[model samples]
Structures are given as structure tokens and as C-alpha cells.
Target: MLSKIHNGVPFKYLIASFQHQPRPTFPRTSPLPLRSRPIRTFSVQSILRLPDSKAQTGSRHKFTYDAAASFSAKHKDFNAATHVFHFNPYNRIQTQKRPKSKRPASGQDAFFISRVGESNAVAFGIADGVGGWEDSGVDPADFSHSFCDYMASAAYEHKPDAGDPTLTARSLMQRGFDDVCRDGSIHAGGSTASIAIASEDGMLEVANLGDSGFVHLRLNAVHSYSEPQTHAFNTPYQLSIVPASMLARAAVFGGAQLCDYPRDADVTQHTLKHGDILIFASDGVWDNLFNQDVLRLASRRMVSLGAWKTSDGGILVADDLKPFTQSLAEDSAQRSSTLQSVIATDIAAAAKTASKDRRSDGPFAKEVQKYYPEEDWHGGKVDDICVIVVIVSEEGKQQAIKSKL
Candidate 1:
């Protein structure tokens, strides 16, 4: 069984049998409001704090962005070419159930990328399954994977002109959580989510819950990042589907499940630049690597690939990103290997190495030390890692004019 230790205390859960129910249609209305819980704060003294930076100023031009994802399972070996996803806006949306074999190789960690209806916008994010549920005879992957799948399908079918409320990142997350709850096959499980919606006009909206998070980077500098919400050390805010039996057991046993709603998520908005980079990942990556570490890795790859250039004044974005974001040939064996994919793979590989290194003190290690000085936790935490990387590129003025003409 999967397990994690925090402050010399091993998390324990109550085991209960669950009853299966019939699946129902996806709910259009929001779930019943749940009271929010007060969370304890934990200081990240070892994390590198960076000043906020504005997006690079440039001429008014229409912009578009491309995305890719790379992941590595904690138990399996990582293969960069085989464990990558290149987002394609023109692909057909899946209406039926997705086959198990078609899922990403992220193991207990899950992610999704989907076009927003017929619009020129995209939605993507990551979800990390709470492993402690395994002790209750629940496979956490079922909940996290199904949640992402529902969100992707919802985004693909969303219509802006349908007279419905505007689809925000938090709303999308709520939709997914509601769908997962209604799914009879999920039984009982929990997960942490980080969701984002990027528009063609260069606006980004993010809704982060629990330890899974995201970071924004531009010109080799960290512009902003999301802070994790936790109930206490090693116990983060999570979306869960607890069975009635489990609830009854907890009510009698005086220990309740940590269930959080989508409304409890922290939402933030950002403006994108021509060469801005966004990285969204599960706690698996964050627990082992710092924000500055991610920025350094991405900056090195961007410069090496000529996506970022150095001039006398300052670092500049490439004139045209088509060369770097171009679609690969359909028949190519390694079609998933793109510039974004390379950067994502590099970051995942590094996190994997750090997780296995006994001498390297990662973010998790530092946090453990702060809480328990006498404990001998001295290395990175090994877990499933999922990372989605996005590259924003503004179309040239001439190209925009040509399209309009």
C-alpha cells in the first residue's frame, strides 16, 4: 500500500466497505454548498521568494499558444518520447468513455488538455491522487483520472452562447468534481487539483486547491506562483467522495474525512506575454523541487533552443515561434517530442532524480526538518509526477493583418 510520513507520524485511515450505486447524468447545477474549514498556515522558509514582474510590453497583436505535457510514474521507468502529450486544437473530442490504455502514463497522477468548445481557447490542468485512501480499499487513481476526464469533456462541449454562466476555472473544477461524485464506479477516493484556462486574448485564470500548484515565468524570471492550501502539515485540502458507510463510521469514531469543495480553491488571474511560460504540476514535483529550480531548468532549455535570446538591452523573445511550435508530421514516430515536450521531460526527469537522491534535501525534506528537528527525514519524497508546460507566442502584426484581410 502507498504511504507517507510527516513529523514522525504516519497517516492512518478507517477502513469501510462501500455499496455501489447507479450512475446518473452529469449535473448542470452546482453541488450543495458546504461550510468551509479553517486551515493552519505553514511557512516555507526555504522557498525562494521572487519579485513580481510585468509582462513584456510589445505592439498590439493577436496571440496564440501551444502546450505539451510529460510525466513519470513513481514505480515505472520514464521514457521521454513515450510519456508525452502534444495538444492539438483541431482534434476531435471524445464523446464516449476513454479506454484505459489511452490514458497518460502518469500513474496515480493525472492531467488533461482540451479545446474550449469551438472557441480559440484551451483548458489544462493536473490532479494528484491522495494515496492514503488505498488503505480503505479504494484506488485513488480512479477518482483523479475520472475527474480530469470529465473536466476535459465538459470543456470540449461547453458553448459560450448557450446563455449559461461564464465558464471559469473554478466552475470547470466544480463540474469535474460533481461528475466524479455522480460516477458510481469511483466508490470513494480523494485528490488535489490545479486547473487553468488560457484564452486567445492572452488572459489566464487558475484555480488551485491543495498542494498541487502552478508557476508563471517570463524572461528567465519567476513572475508569480500559487500557494498551497493545507489543513495542517502534510494534510492538504482535498476534494473527496466519501461513502455513506465511511461517513457513518467517521461520525461515530470522532474522526472525519478531509473533504473540501471547489469553492474553497484559490483563484488567480494573469496576463500572458509573447514568450511567457506556464508550468502546472502535481505535489510530486513541488515536494521535490523549488520554484526557482523549475525556472532555472525552463530558462536553460528555452535559451538552448533559441526560443529566448539575449540582446544588449535585455533578454528578448524570438521574433517568430512557429519554428519551435510547429506541428510534427502525422506519420512521425516521435510526434510528441516538441520544444515544450523537451522542457517538460527535462523537468520531470530532474524531479525523478531528486526524489531518489538520498543526499539532496528537497522542499519536503526542509519542511520535515522544520516540523520535527529530531526526525531523520533527509531526502526528497518519491511520488508520481505530472507536469504540463505551455508556451505563449504572439502572432506578428503582419500575420494578424494577413488573417484579417
Candidate 2:
């Protein structure tokens, strides 16, 4: 549903005592109070070859809307995405993880929690599956699911190392990527990933692969996660991995070689105010808007916090004093992003504009375009996108990462 908050409200979550409000039937698919939309058709398909599966079986989480989100708390132990936001259709396909299989499985998206404290230390994420690749009857929905679980585990258990949470996060993601590659599915299927971690001290740490991102609303302004545009529309991210010497030989795109910089990083730290809001979304939600747009939406909410409840009474507090918290992000200057609303809006506008203009005919090509800027878009055109935006305050502190390795 095209849920909008042209005003402010309080924040709430896992509202167990709430009622289930199914999306109202609109003309579109399973419509329920969603924005008016006509069925969109794809003209081309794109293929994505991701890492192979490995044998590590256990319970994991995934999404059904080809999109998902992670938050600091748990409504229940059920494997599902926390933080109530509607699934973004730009993502398209979603999957879950399994044990000992070469790939993941297809299933409903559930929330998974690995507590760092009573409600302090936690990590959550969402991944979008590639559609064109799945057309061959080979869905990596499961692979994306496994990737999120693996990544979340690593984040929750991260060490302080360099105050560089990004480095640590990327290393873990690469390890996961490497594991899949070693198993033999490097070219089978792939997904876009985004994650957020809460520090016991009340800070934010984030990592990303592909375009999914995070947005933060502190006091009055909004902010976003790191920027990612590794390749141009004509090339692919992996294509640049070959012989540094050969690439040194061709150097075709002329763009700065995909920023060797990790797709992830350590977000700045600061005291979270009460009037704040954070949001993480797949390309579907972001491909259509920008930070100002998000701010515009936030300004509409008449309450301190407001998130349209989508899941089973998913509690999105309408009055959480987040406004008091976010109201300070800009003046704080001690942190990075302003807040989730700011970040999500900016990213979405760029991605949506870009997706509408892609010309390639790759498998899942429709999905990959969600990561670029609409006007001057040029990059590897990663197949899927994942985004995470968060609002923090004295009431909403980050869950610390418990070092595992």
C-alpha cells in the first residue's frame, strides 16, 4: 500500500494487542489501501550469477514481497522483518535460507532476532532476489535469505576493531560471498542486501551490497547511508574483478574503478534524540522518491512517530517523541545521516528515476535499474537494491554487536 505520513505521529512496534488490517483491494495485485497504480510490465529480463550454496542448515528469515527490513526489537521470535514498512515491488522476488543446500528456499518472510541485550544489541536486514535468473527455475531467494542471516549474525557479533564498523561488516559480507563462490554458484543467482546494527551505547552501524539503503530522521533533518555506484549502465560490478592487469588493459567505462571502498561503513555516532525516525527499503519504495520527499512525508505526520502498520498489528508508534529526538540530528553535527526519512527519500527519488530509463535486456534487468539515479544514471546497474533507514532516540538505542570471532 502507498502508505503516507504527510504529518507526525508517535512510534510503536509489535503491537500484539492490535488487529490485522489486510491491504484493501485496489485494482492492482492484492490491493488494500495502496496508492493507485496500473500493472507495470517488463520488456526485458536480466540474469545475475551469484555465489553457490553451501551446507549450513538452520532456521533463517526471508521476505515475500521481494523486499524486507530489520529493526532493533522483536515482536515475537518468529523469523520476520521488524520495522513496519510495506514491501517495495521494485525488488520483485524474495527467498529464505535452509541448511546444507547449494541455494536457499522460497517461503514467507518472517522476523528473526539475535539479541545483544534485553532490547539493545540486535541486527536485521533484507535482500531482494533476482527475477530473470529465477525464470530458469533456479531461484536464489534462499541464497539472499542465507546472506541476510549470516550478515546479521556477524553484525550483532561485531568487534570494535577500528571504530570502523563498515570494514568489519564488509569483511563479513565478503566472507559470505566467498563462501558461496567457493561452493560453485557464482553465476547462478544473486541479490541486493542492506543491514543495520544497534550499539549498546546507542549508535548506528550499517553495511550494504547493491543499492538497498538506510535513512535517518534526527530532530528536524533527514540523512542516508553510504553511496554506491560501482559500475556504469554498460558494465557489471563483477566484470571489473577480472585481471586487474586486463582491466588495467581495457579500462572501458572510464568511471573510477568501482570504489574499492566497501559497500558498507561505520556510520557516525551521536546521542539519539526522541523525535527521530529511521527507514530502510528495497528499490521499490526508494525508486520513486528523494530525501526532501521523505522529509515532506515526515512533515505531514501530525504525531511524534507514524508508520502505517502492514504486518499483523505491526506496532508503528504514532507518538514516540521521535520528533524531539530527530529535531536535534542536524544541530548535533556529531553524527552522519540526519535520519531515516531524509535518507530514504533522497535514495528513492534517484533510484526510481533511473529504473524508468534503463535500456539493457538482461535477466531481471527491471530489478537492477532500481539502484541508479534517474537523470544521469550510469553504473554497474546491480540487479537488485536493498535500503535501511533508522530513527534513534533515548528510547530507541542501538543494540551492541557481540563479537563472535
Candidate 3:
């Protein structure tokens, strides 16, 4: 048996691998009609897999500056330019999900971070391949990675009109899915996608399908969240559960018919404020950690950080954060690794306590009951967990202001 962390917590890992079979040709999906749609904007707060335990210091944090997409031009009333964003992402393969035989490892979870086009706007997302596709002789990871790549492209190509982000995001899923099926490189496997786009105008648009989700925080408290679209407990809506067709669609499981419709997504918009943070995660993180736990854990880290940047250029630690991170670096080979360890330990502890407490019927109890109904439920639920944290700092806000001037 293997052990791993879900939602920054420790849990028993379950291993399973998909044997790669020859890719078969499938009918290509026709492009969905492009139409402008109106999206509701809520007056509210805004809001990684680790390749390694340590932060990768090789590259500068990818922040693209596009001169044409200034915040002032988009919305002249607010003298702010696009929000300059920074992010930290972490990913780990679940030991339980590994195949015992000697085979190339396939990870179904994929995360992406990039600057949207020439704009200072940032985009981040996570895609989880449906585990059910393993039995169909297809690898979900391929689908997930390809889908996320398209999402990043969609973000870059997006041109919002009338301050409406609906059409921009809708086009990404519609066209991206078509390209994914048209290309012969990727297999016909289904997956779930959760995407967050922080526009140059400081407005946020999050679009999602299935269980992957995100939480938004203002200072230490949660301001909003992207709701998970699950048919039932443990059964999430995915791109395409059936391998017969290469369409990107989702439906309720348990005797429900699935389709290839690309528009089956839940999209929401939010107006962000300074000092806001957004956490995008797969089901693994949401199932194990409740909203409050996420809040508590993040708030705790914010304190431990004692005013620091989570990602500097490409390095996880910046000069100003050296003193605060020095203690963490001493404990582990990398400061990011140490931070991951601490967050995981804290989340696991929270899950344990929440399971026993019947007072609140939240995600913890539901997760334990859903995943471990047959056995004694202890600790957190076992699943592949990935988390991406993005902060909109005072400095970032100031930079946005300067860009407009």
C-alpha cells in the first residue's frame, strides 16, 4: 500500500495504471457554433503539482505584458491596468494510483499557468482525466494534458467584448475540444476541466466541468468558490466517459447517457479586490479539505509567511522572504518542499478531526463516507490532489495602476 496527500493532507494511496493500447481512429467532432453570450457578474471577492519538493529557480515567473490590452482601454472608469499575477502550483502522484507492473507512469492530473496573450492577464487551470476510462484501454492523462493545453491557448486567444467573458471562454472549450479530437496525436479519453482567467481589468472568470474547482479568498477569509458539478458523490461529470466517440461532453453517472456537447460547463464571473488569493484544485483537494479548513490552512500559511511572495520570478523564495523561509529551508532540501509538507500535514489533521465531528455535514464526512463506506474511515480520502495558489498583492495592484498611467 502506498501513502500520499490529498488536499495537502496524508492518506492511503490506491495504485492503478492504464495499459496503453494502440490508438484507434474516431470520428472528428464538428466545431460548435460561435455565439456571443451574456454572463452574470457577481459583486464579490476574487480569487501545482510540484514537479519537485523544492521551487524551480531556473526560469523567471511567466508574467506576460501586452501593451495593447491595457486595463484603462478596456474599462476607462477604473484607472487600473491588468492585474499582474503570480502563482505557486504543486502536483504529486498518488502511490495507490500506480500500476504494480513495470510500465510507464501515467498521471491523469494536469495543471497550467500562463499570461493571457500580450496582456498582463493571468490564466491558471487543472484537468483531471476520468479514472473510469482506464478500463477502456485508454490513458486519461493524455486527454487531460491536451485539453489543458487547449485551455491555455484559448486564454491567450480570448478577446472579450463589452466586458463580457462568456464568449471568450466558451470559444476556448468549443474550439479547443474540436482541435483535440481533430488531432491524431491524442487518444479519446474523457477528463474534467477547471479554468480561471484573471483579466487585465481585474475581473475573474472561472469555467468548470466535473469535480475540479477553485476557492477565492480575501485576506484570510473565503470570498467565493467555483462549485463542483458532480452527478452524485464520487461521480463527477467528465468530457467523455465513453471511448466510442471523441467528443468533449459530460453527463450524470449511474445509468445516465453521456454526450459530446462541449458547452456543458458552469461558468461564473467575479470582481476581484486587492489582497485577494485564488486556490484552484482538483477533486482530491476539495474532497478532503472543507472550505473552512482551506481557509484555516491558508490563513495559517499567510501568517507563517509573515508577508512574503510565494513565487518570485520563477523561484519559490524571493530575497525579502529569505528570513521567514530560512527556517523552512533548513528543515527540508527546498523551501517549497517544506511548505508542501507542512500544508499537507495540517490538512490531514483537519480532515481527521472533521470526520469525527458530526456537527457540520461538510466535505470531510461526505468524502469519507463516499470513498471508504465499506471500511473504517480515518484520515483523508485517497485521490490525486493538485493545488494552484495565486495572489493579487498590493504590489501587483500598484503595478497595474502604473501600467495604466
Pick the lDDT winner.
1
lDDT of 3: 0.48
Per residue, candidate 1 scores C-alpha lDDT tens digits across 142-193 of 8888899999999999886797677899999999999999887888888999
Mind giving the per-residue lDDT tens digits that candidate 2 earns over 1-405?
Answer: 223211111111110111110111111222223121111100111111111223221312110111122221111221122222322223222222345352222221222223322223445555554332333345455455555555544444445443535433456556445554444443444555555554434455566554444456543356443343323321112211222432453354332323222343333343343345555555444434445555555544423234222335433333333332233243343132222433333443334334344442221232223332132222212223334444343322222112232
The TM-scores of all predictions, comma-separated, are 0.83, 0.43, 0.58
RMSD of each: 10.0, 18.9, 15.1
Pick by lDDT: 1 or 3, better one: 1
Which pairs, if any, clash in model 1? none
Between candidates 1 and 2, name the one with more favorable lDDT.
Answer: 1
Error of 1 at 90 (Å): 1.3
What candidate 3 gets wrong by more than 4 Å, as runs, is 1-106, 157-167, 241-257, 308-378, 394-405
- Compared with the true structure, all predictions reach lDDT values of 0.76, 0.35, 0.48
What total of clashing residue pairs does each candidate reach?
0, 116, 21
Model 1 residue 177 CA deviation in Å:
0.8
